[model samples]
Target: MSAPANAAVPQAEQSLRDTVLSRGYLRLLLLCVLLGVPIALACFFFVGLQHLLQHWVWESAPEALGYAGPPWWWPLPALVLAGLILAPIVTRVPGSGGHLPVNGLGGAPVGPKELPGTVLAALATLPLGVVLGPEAPLLAIGSGLALLAVRRSAAADAKARAVVATAGSTAAISTILGGPIAAAVLLIEGAGLGGARLVALLLPCLLASAAGALVFTGFGDWTGLETGALALGELPSAAGPDVGDFLWGLPVAALIAVLVTLGRELGRSTVGFTRRGSKAARTVACATAVGVCITAYALITGRSPAEAALSGQATLAELAADPHAWSVGALVALVACKGLAWAVSLGSLRGGPIFPAVLLGTATATAFSGLPGFGTAPALGLGIAAAASATTGLPLASAVLAALLLGGDAAEQMPLIVAASVVAFIVGQLVRRQRPEGATDTAGAAGAAR
Candidate 1:
């Protein structure tokens, strides 16, 4: 009986392998490679434009206006304008200007009809200092374009379309997050899939992401344009973590998880608020509130509002390169102000939630680095992994993302990073379980509006 059972298992495995390696699946794989090119190009231009607009708003405009940097009052008007611009798109356009950041990045792919709204909403808000990142919009664009290309084909069923959409989205975000591996890891962990089904989805995602990375790199080199990849330029040097680092890091990671989860709760509350009244008015109000937070950070810390505004990628790089440049008070203010802005933006704005969450964690960890056992590098890695894990609810992806960000230092830090991510993920789950039942209803209602 045991021998017979083992024989049946091999038969089943062979059947699964045969299905995946069939001619149709092979065709689909080839299509993913072709699909990756255009998707990558679209994302490249999309991110480039957003970066240009951001530079103008925060840098060029300030210089053009004869100010050394943007004054404290700058974000107020800029964010108001962003709100005004984004209001109509979110209220009137289809797809409600893409999925709310609070929803995480697991929603249905944006179709062709919804792409314009996603682009408009992101352009209107993100460049103007809405505390969000481009990953959401890029995901939308990639999926929409992929669907648009294949929508007329009778052969493309729902499952095929879904696979292609996943591939396209991964391709779209590949460069931004480092590469296809990180993007694929995000999908794999976030999807909660297993076995043959997971493998089926994984193949196209990897192929598309590889092609996309190639296009992104080629175009960036050819055109001398920036791809706006997430990177850490310089990090404080540190050897492998000592026992003390782990002792302090474990608690700090938990604290970071709590804070990130708290931000998500705040986002859920904001979602309820936005849905209660006129969405347009409330959206503008929320944008302005984010602006107010950015302004407050600048005023309180006497630092550039740019540090608190936009996606935190630039600030993240700066902080990583030179952690000591910022005082403890300044780091605290960043966590408070940018964290609030990030939470609000998560509910009411059109963007991704992960980037700012990572920054919050990094800031928090850097602030606590003075503790007896904690070194800046270990804390930085731990903070990144913990915050990302908490925000995305994907410990493996968070760990991988932190490792990628850590670059050469990643080898030494991987163990601590992985532990931190797991701790954060567990804590985040507990926090979600603790949320009031009513919050789920509010989230559903908010989801319905989008």
Candidate 2:
């Protein structure tokens, strides 16, 4: 009787465990969908706002502000205004205005309580020609809003709230990142999560991302503009990889890795310095200096000032389509100017670093493609992966983004991108490991001395 009873108990426990797991997963999935709605809405709002701002900057702002053309100094005053607005909000608000989106890529989860200030600050800085992208703010806003919604509701459990927050954040930029898969992969790889837990987390994330994409598409259609999943035009046919291609990739990857390491350190130092300085001073000084540098570059190169500022997506696209349009020297200069601008931007602004880094890499690769045996398109793809992976410390996502951006040409370029990513990853890791024991002290000393 005792043996029989024990056997029944084990069976009953197993059934109960299965029941709980199933119920938990189901609830999480539902919560993820619910959380995803607000994030999608926020992303839609920001993207729409950006489009409106672009139109205003190009057409209305010049006339409205009494400028002869898109005033090169236009972004500066706006940036200063943004800084003033953001400073007080961040100081008084929770979550430090969503952890400065520029610095939040590999950061931990933040709650909904911090949404208002972060979203406001990001909107102020992002469209003002600050060298940052909307990706980080989108994530913060999406997740924060979702968390807030969940908190207001009485039905959400602790586990359900966590799942929703994660899903909302992941879905916010899902389409912006080419697709939801890339965003999902980024979260998974960056967080080092796996197994059944990962699957449970992913189901909701994927669902939310799908929903976000749908929302973005609907809004874009309504606005008569483009949004969601960047379209690659006229992809060149991919050829099989050769030994020479692989060999050429190694050195280029190594060079980009080194540049990324330098940029990362510079960004860290700049951010620290700015954080310690008076907010207004840092905002004005950085904006003025960057503005001057960009103006000089544009004047010197006889190119649009846009080339010297922002994330350079347009420049990158043009270069990729026709490398010969710009002189190699000009491209090289663009790389240097943009890199420095991005470093400074990271220090004093709130935005993502990925776009600028990709732009820099693409420009460099396009310039170097004049060499024998290296095709422009392939080199651009490889450099994109290498530089992105090195800077963001996400090799897999880099490889996928490069490949996806290449579209049909991904097959041939995929291997090269992967190889470059691996090398960059190793170089970046080694550089990170080799930092001096008193690096923080040294950095502080340098800042103080400055």
Candidate 3:
């Protein structure tokens, strides 16, 4: 006489409806709407400042020194300075510079006390070319700022605080993901929302994101400040997937998954290494090693070290706009150098992992564009989807993210993108599961460092 699964649906629906109608939820909805604007504004300023500082360090300073761009040795000093600044924050700061990127963006919401450390760590390192993204720090900042709005008495209600924090996070993250839809899908898939709880949380998040998007749109127009969001502008034309594209995309996606998994393994090893010695010294050593990797890429390819040093947003855009700019051999070197820097940064630095992984995927896929059936556009889309799915372990979100990045051409390439995402997701899971039991536990070890 157990209740049927179908029977639970109505009860869940009724509970969701009741919850939505409740006064507390109504208040929360209002709070989310109100909070979204400010949260997005804060994120806007944060991202804007980070970009400005980055431009100064990499562009202005080098130009002042009469170089076309940063010299090959430029990253060494910049990264050393970054390490010196970041070491103290990671060791002494309350949040340990926020969670290590190897943990894949799942953790408790940050509180106000940890906000300074998180922001300082990102500003200090990311602008100095740490090969990490700003998403995690933005997430931490949003959640912390939101929690700060709660009354001391209300703080005891963990559930309400979490919801508000999530809403704030969605709003802040929405600014960077171009808009709320991809951000919402990302959080939904990453958090595994379902059932009544899903319905309950979805409303607040959606409201916050929508409101935040509106504010960001208006503010950018008014202030004329660049948000430096992750988006591609001029992509090469693409057509619908033919049988050949699908056939070739499968193994390509799997290969990307394997490559990304290897990067994560390297991150685990870094976590283990950082744990053994004086944490501060070890962190600086990892940072300097990342600098060496960037220097190696610049020396070998005769390109700017910036290409291999920071989060790969600009390089990705450049690659999408003109894949021909990079020779296959150069792309391979970019992959090798940037991939190692990214892997080390993942366990020792404070930033998001998804951006560089997407770049890595794109580089790898673009190298294979000359394959029998693979066109450059299809290769680009497949690489983006596969890398994103593998790195984040959220196939549906990765598909949406890839489609968003691919822009109008994505409509034609959706099928290929979806297939690649699914393939990469499955392959990534298999790779992780296949790791030996004695292997360094990337998530656990990285989490401990945090």
Candidate 4:
């Protein structure tokens, strides 16, 4: 009787395991399809929107507000009004107007109900030159909407909810990255997912990315904007790293790591300071200061003020394409100016730091490209990857992003980028580790006191 009872117990446990696995796998597949398609589509839509806006909306809107136009000071009043409105929205809204971009990049996820406010807030804030990127809001809004859709149609299970939310977030910025693969990898690695679950999660992300590419391609076609090419023209050939190049890169990366750490600290301190002040006062003051800095940079460097104020992608691309256009002094100035501007933006505004960081890194590399053994393109590529990795602590994502941006040269430059990133990561980790535990406790207490 004992032996028979034991046999039945094992059988019952096996049956339960089978049921769970069966359901889990099935739910996983469903999540992949639902989230993947929407994310890809959203990415597609965003790309299309950007293209249209660049070519048509902004171009067609009056020259005053267009890219070629002078900086629109008239928008300042509206922006201030928006900030006033946003303060209340942020205070009243659940999840503080949805998950912040910084939090999302740091691996936080958002739910369905928060999508609308996230999108609206980001669109309003970013275009006003609030010194942020759309990436974070993109993730929050995308995931939130996806979750809302799924919950309405399907029964809510914890696993299912997580899977769908993840998928939505993945879909949101699938195309902002060169491809869906990088975004998927970022989400998977950042989340620390593993085993069969990783495989299951990747399927939906990949599918969504592919869908996003297609959607973006279609929209580009309709809008007459160039789209769908992942590679930037022909891949530039990479020059092998000489011994001196490696040595120089190590020090450059270390210096950059320190600068990045400082920038982060500055941003945190500024944010803390601003939080103690009136929101309206802080926002206006920060924006005015950013505008003054941008105007000064442009006046001193003979570049457009807008160049200093925007995401700096276009400027980075130009610098990468022609390193000699700007002198080393100019590049260094831009880096300093951009870094300070970015830090300021983080204090009182909302946006993603990713693009600005990449811009600064690429600019730094370009500035130093004339040194022996370091050419323009390779330096730009390596620096961008290393700086991004150091700040974000997403080494793989940074490597892949830099590689994608570098096109065919990716294989050749991958080794150096990886090496530099390792050094930068070590530097970052070391600095983080060295911070006193009590300092964090004190900071937390201070924040609480406010």
lDDT per model vs. reference: 0.85, 0.67, 0.83, 0.63
User: What ranking emerges by lDDT with the best candidate at the front?
Assistant: 1, 3, 2, 4
Quote the lDDT for 104 in model 2.
33
Instruction: Decide which is better by lDDT, 2 or 3.
Output: 3
Per-residue CA lDDT of model 3 for 1-450, tens digit only, reads 467988989999999999999998998899889988999999999999999999999999999999999999999998888888888988998998888898777677788998889998998889999998888888887788888887474433777877888888888878878799988887766665463465345435533553455456457667999899666664665566666777887798899999998898789889889989799999999999999999999999999999998889999999999999999988999999999999999888889898999999999999988889888888889899999988887776787889899888886677678778877877888887465665433221111112
Give the range of the ten consecutive residues with the poorest summed lDDT in model 4. Answer: 441-450
Q: What is the overall TM-score of model 4 with all chains considered together? A: 0.76
Question: Best candidate per TM-score, number?
Answer: 1
RMSD of 4: 11.0
TM-score for all models, in order of appearance: 0.87, 0.78, 0.86, 0.76
Candidate 3: global Cα-lDDT?
A: 0.83
Best by lDDT: 1
Residue range 1-450, candidate 2, lDDT tens digits: 799998999899999888768976777677677767667876887878875775665457777877655555554565566566556665566766655423436454556666666677676666666676677677776666777777877877775666666677678868487778878766666554453365346435533553454456456556887554566554567663455556776688878888766776677777776777586567557666566666666666766666767666666777777889889889887877777777777766666777788888777777777777877767888788887887676677777778777877775566677777777777877775465554431100011011
Models ranked on TM-score: 1, 3, 2, 4
lDDT of 3 at 9: 90
- Local accuracy of candidate 4 as per-residue lDDT tens digits, 172-252: 767677768877766765664454365345435543553454456456556898755665464457654555566677678
Model 2 segments more than 4 A misplaced: 1-21, 63-82, 101-104, 152-159, 194-236, 433-450
Candidate 1 Cα deviation (angstroms), residue 207: 30
lDDT score at residue 46, model 2, on the 0-100 scale: 83
**Which candidate, 2 or 4, would have the higher lDDT against the true structure?**
2
